[model samples]
Target: MNKILLGGLAALALVAGIAPAAAQTVEFTVINNSSYDLHYFYTTPSNEDHWGDDLLGDSGVLEAGYQATATIGDGSDQCLYDFKFVMDNGAELIEPEIDICQLSSYTIND
Candidate 1:
């Protein structure tokens, strides 16, 4: 397991907003184009105060050059969210204010 950067998640949590929703489950394909394996994935509603839980919890890591379909069923009406990606080397990457309802796929590249 990679060391999660609490500071990075904290920074992302500071930006908050409520967005209109179009669906109950925000489904999207995530492509890992980076060199490092993706150890963890997290999605938090933009209106929330903290990163709730790991979407990839206990399943497996998203290996490099591969993709996976992620379904977020947080039961929130907000569509906008902040995504946190933890690499195998303890690197943290964050994409803020992503409208999951409008996107079909998201890619993480080196």
Candidate 2:
């Protein structure tokens, strides 16, 4: 009985340790500062200049001062790269760029 209890505890600990971290969905409010309406695209750092499944293309036109939210992966190793925003007109931006390595502020919820 003692051995079984210990095994159960060990299994629980293993599950806790191995489970993927919670997904994080961050929102960015992008402003279209240019005179013309703009289209945007996003790609992971690994595919900086290439469009892949990870690439999030422009959803709609953005007028000046308009904002939109872009979602990106945020769980375990699968959640790679800091989220980025780019204009099809050739502009680039990254959300929480300063906080890229600051994981402590992130609340993990699964």
TM-scores, one per candidate: 0.77, 0.38
Most lDDT-accurate candidate = 1
Error of 1 at 104 (Å): 0.2
For model 2, residues 1-110, the per-residue Cα lDDT tens digits are 22432343344344445445663433333345555444443434342444333222323444444434333333323334544444445665554332323332322111
The parts of candidate 1 lying over 4 Å away from their true place are 1-23
Candidate 2, run of 10 with poorest lDDT: 101-110
In order, candidate lDDTs are 0.73, 0.39
Give the C-alpha lDDT of model 1. 0.73
Off by over 4 Å in 2: 1-23, 46-59, 74-110
Clash totals in order:
0, 0
